[model samples]
Target chain A: MASPPTPLRAPEHQVAGHQAAEGRLGPLVDGAGLFFKPLQGDGRGDDEVSFYTLLSSLPSSSLPSSSFFPSFHGTRLLPASDGSGPHPHLALEDLVAEFSNPAIVDIKIGSRTWYPQASEDYIRKCFEKDQRTTSASLGFRISGIQIRDGSGAWKPDRGEIRRFSPRDVRIALRRFVSSDPRSDPDRALAAAVYGGADGVLAKLGELKRWFEEQTLFHFNSVSVLVVYERDAGATLGKGKVKVKLVDFAHVVEGKGVIDHNFLGGLCSLIRFISDVLTGLDENCI
Target chain B: MASPPTPLRAPEHQVAGHQAAEGRLGPLVDGAGLFFKPLQGDGRGDDEVSFYTLLSSLPSSSLPSSSFFPSFHGTRLLPASDGSGPHPHLALEDLVAEFSNPAIVDIKIGSRTWYPQASEDYIRKCFEKDQRTTSASLGFRISGIQIRDGSGAWKPDRGEIRRFSPRDVRIALRRFVSSDPRSDPDRALAAAVYGGADGVLAKLGELKRWFEEQTLFHFNSVSVLVVYERDAGATLGKGKVKVKLVDFAHVVEGKGVIDHNFLGGLCSLIRFISDVLTGLDENCI
Candidate 1:
């Protein structure tokens, strides 16, 4: 007695230049809070599949807590939204399913996204992109952002987010936590979401700590997906803010060396958020 | 039946000018790895008793994990080490009991140790002491330190630790992790103890995150007891480094306000330790 899957209604925050073509089966969600992402069939897809399988097989103690990433349900063959032939899709926990009005941002962390094994052409492409974006200077860049306003309507900035200057990124982050992105920031909610015990910044600190010590996998071109219920009351309760590490297609073995590249980017992101929090505090006083 | 308690042979790191007389029962240890701290009859002791009782009564979910502090086993009237009269003592987990050669440092955190409720004279006394030590400038002061040398003997530096200049404090911290404190810094151990996953810095970061959000209590005049096995191999295993928040006599209720004083001190200490790690890395290179 299960119903057929439906197209995901919420905005699909995808990497720049990687959005699914119009009318094709993109992401689907069922009533059970399961999200189905159609596999790209590219090498990256296979790498992600392998990474998930390796993560699932590893002892839980050796890996970061399962909460740090979307809970993987397994790969499945599912029909597309247009009722086309079954294609492989990744089933994962719909992180924002419970939020009535969720604000989300995908920040790609790292100054260099290309791996050591990448081809010269790929390296050149990534290097050019890095230099053109905020990543070269800040070690991170906002890939996508969507915030719900007072009336519960989402205002999404997708393409422009990737080219945001450092100042633009700061403003965008401030707007992400604002009650109305079109207006002034909501100081109280900003404090609660950014500095709260379970806020975005605290969660990032936890992830940073894990990265500092974890010698298992080197995460390259990974995005930290930050989501929060914008409509939640001023006092954001426990678990209101959700931060997950996504886009692991570029992950590599640690080989007994610490992942300084990833750690550096994470620390950079942390500093940015901390600066945002400090600015909010000063403005209030 | 359990055997009688034995005098703690390890150097007792106490508050400056507060050391017990040579013949007095300062601290005791049992085979069960329980440390018995002889309570001072002063008001500070009563305050500590109340704090521990309050901590024990609070739901574990409301407080930081018990691992952040010595596990309180309740206050009890215990016989003195010299078979004298039984006196009240705080029974806590012996943090360094398992280490055959432990290096320990008690860094008292907070720029100001006196609370608003203290008498004018007491405030003046605390102010003078704060001004005289690194607490005023660094937000923390090394109250005591003991590092085990190659001969497995403790090199106790108690009184002078409290008077260490900022630079001296950094040197002392570096020495705390060095295999041979009498010689050059042990780059490998320094990296392992300061930057390693379960090392002192990571644990402090955890505590800092909790402090940033928790409104349960304002920790005043707290001491972060850092302990690690000096003899642990290059790759210090999990649980080799132990950081515990101790000395709750000056703790006050949070009253819905973040403890900025303690948080500031902790962040300062973290920066210092991070600098040490960075220096060690540069030296190795």
Candidate 2:
């Protein structure tokens, strides 16, 4: 009754940052809203699967509202986009599907992506990477960014974003919101997308509040995915800008302790966005 | 087929603070979710009516979401509870109608309640009151508060709250969340209600973000009404704790200028609540 899934084209439509290096398996889409991410055969895939399953079973009251994460629609077996035969794929709501043209940024939060239970090699690898990026000092790093230009084409920055310094990260964020060169020079959309009721900052504040008290999981290497419509005349409305948690392969049980690592990084990100808002205001003055 | 409207008898259920002094007209309910607030025949009532009416006509995209204010249900002619015959009332959504034994606080935000267009006598009166209360220094003052005590009885603190100093305001807020003595010693409800998504702080943050950029109406003498269930076992859930903007009698057109007066008071209130949250965490430690 339905057509087989097709590979998600366009770099802007795919998960940006770390996935670029993985080069193993890419995600698929139904051309509809469903996003099918090929599950890794390693334990990482099982870990993510279990996390989503556990989240599904827990009372929603005990967790952040569903909007904070991609809506889980269970796992599905699908033909791999790479023609690697049928493989188990995670069925998730496409974060950017609703937008005509979207500007997206993938930020991996936390100063450390290694947990106490992680292998020594993994810890060392993550530590080196953290030190090389702005994450070590600023508690967050821009993993990837993609924004549409005046001509209605996507301009994605991945290599430079991954290596961005703190100042560069700030500039990258500004660029993410200020991309459509044809828009108003004042960049009102920045405030609307980053500071509105359902904007990225508000959503992050909600997640930070939950992280401050939640004793369920210690999320390592998780990404805060921000997406917003980049159409020339777009203004913030309901669901105009989306902020969601993705990539939970490194999650561990909280063991009744707060996730200070994640919380600190989140606070840093909030501060940066707040600064951007203030800067925008000062510039207008 | 419908029952006649009845006066809201319980003091805890009524709008606290300024209403206690007004004593002119009070709100009524149909035992349903609709709140019928008696409109003053004076210009103040017409001002509020105009604001609500204008708000109703605006596309929701152009204003803060309706949840920020109680859902306006248009005007209605109702028989006053005091047997004042039929009077025009602003029928609004009853914010606390669903809560069981709710703890409510009415905080009048802004340092200067008097507007440029107000009579000199009114300005002097408001200035004197602001100076006497914590509002002059702290940018906000507790207008009234009602919380359930250990015995499950309402404890209305009006006089003391109205005249609360900054220190006293902080204590009053702490007590508002920690009212149920039989609950967990750590006061998880404090973080849950004040820090959770859709909680008072989160909602205030949303309002602040909107105020920072919006050049619509300058809200003066308005109250940020906070309400939550004080039932011993109550936990945060959807629509559990409500934070709303109320009493727009002094609102004025912004004329393309930001409402710095209201914004300053909002930030101050946010700081105080953030302090309460931090102090709560220290006490638990």
Candidate 3:
């Protein structure tokens, strides 16, 4: 068995999913479901595990219920195809399958990415090099990767990681509003989620409140991945969207005052997204 | 030194406060000040110590920077003037001094009086009996004992503990709205804090959000004391009011799903108070 770990493979538990004949990312569980996380070397993964467990146990009435978080299955130990020893891996619900267009964006909130730092040297380096700013810019780094196809076969994804800055979002919205929905499915879908200026701003306001009011949200840093899809064959103005918060390695007990830097940064990031949506709504119509 | 603490007395350290010549609750600090808590057993006073310490550490930017909490002075070990050795007591900022006519009302929130169980047997008994309903009735048990008199000397308050059920509030408001403020000072003061029906309700909404958003409010039960004073000489309707949250013995760590029963009970209590204030506002003019 390999000592370290190996890349994720098709799930061993068989289910009648997609049939491979269609040459598509085969029959997936309803929704654009896809779960992929880098393996943890230290114990940060443990924190994530506990967080999911806590979330699962919460009473339904605790929050305004929605499918806000990805479901957690269990961990799996896979044996290398070469017959090496079993290595540990986490099994997470794939959210990509929930969408048709399946555009995903991962936005990180807060300045200090790692609290109770992995190492003092690492924290020192983070400060010395100004990684925070660099990390913000690195939002462009992730390429939309391949997903599983029919017959549990994985294939490369063609979707690109698009940056919806204020300007970009505005342009997208304008195009969406100006073009007939019947003629432009993609723009229509984007417009639906973006909501016209006021609607989009209102939704973002609610999201901001959610973040601020969440009782368990004590992590020094969190990455919120918004997954949205546009189905060309479906209604022009309607799109599927799901948002999931990830990276719970730094969750802390009980509320204390949130750091000003983190609070301000999170606000700015959300404002940027909101601005983009607003610009789109205003310019398009 | 007394084994158990005694009632608050004139501070050993003198400041230019009320000159006790005339029998009156003399000159006090301006701004809705008042702090009066029963002494605790089993060292729960220690929790208050830490709570104040934490509040003092918080930057001014947090919590909108109102005097939302009573300020804490240091603790003192006072030796009896008769050479009776020293006893520990807390030195808190006199909230009574904050108001010109400092009328303080203490409202406790939550069905659970203790968290993490101050005593196991007590918790067991609480569970065995439905104490929630009983606690609602317990509001009437606190007598409006006499407070300070001339010279800033402490005295047993003779005021009766008044229970403002929803109906009682309605009646109070009716009386307030109908009566002439020039003739009834007390009614006028109540009317001012209630802010007329609509204003009072709006303020309650804001207060609800404040409690929900405060990350540190994990206490099993919280007591909100609203201090208001009618500036009889200023205007018929003007009043100075401030609210403070007290009692940290049951404070708990980080956010988790709050108990539904507790949340529900809190809402009910606040609604009851809000209604009472509304009645006062509506009735008073």
> If you assessed candidate 3 against the hidden native complex, which CAPRI class would it receive?
incorrect
Task: State TM-scores per candidate.
Answer: 0.50, 0.49, 0.41
The residue pairs in collision within model 1 are: none
How does residue A125 of candidate 1 score in lDDT?
96
The models' CA-based lDDT, in order, is 0.71, 0.72, 0.42
Reference contact recovery of candidate 3: 0.00
Error of 1 at B249 (Å): 51
Candidate with better TM-score, 1 vs 2: 1
**Could you give the candidate ranking by TM-score, starting with the highest?**
1, 2, 3
The residue pairs that clash in candidate 2, if any, are none
Q: In model 3 chain A, where is the ten-residue run with the lowest total lDDT?
A: A138-147
lDDT for each residue of candidate 2 in A30-135, tens digit (9 for 90 to 100): 6678777778876888898899999889887888874687888888887665666777878888778788877778899876677657887997799778778877
Tens digit per residue, CA lDDT, model 1, A44-125? 7778888988888888788666378888888877776555778777777887787776778888887667765677798779
Question: lDDT tens digits, residues A1-285, model 3?
Answer: 122233443432212222223332221221224343333447766777777778779887654444556787655544423233444444567766545544444545543354443577765664333242422221111212222222332222223223333334334323333323323323433455555443333444555455444434554556555544434455433235555555666666522221322333344444344434445234322
Ten consecutive residues with minimal summed lDDT in candidate 1 chain B?
B9-18
Clashes of 2: 0
For candidate 3, what is the TM-score?
Answer: 0.41
For residues B151-245, write the lDDT of model 2, one tens digit per residue.
76434466666667666676667777774533433444678788877788888988877876675788889999998887667766768888889
The model with the greater TM-score, 2 or 3, is 2
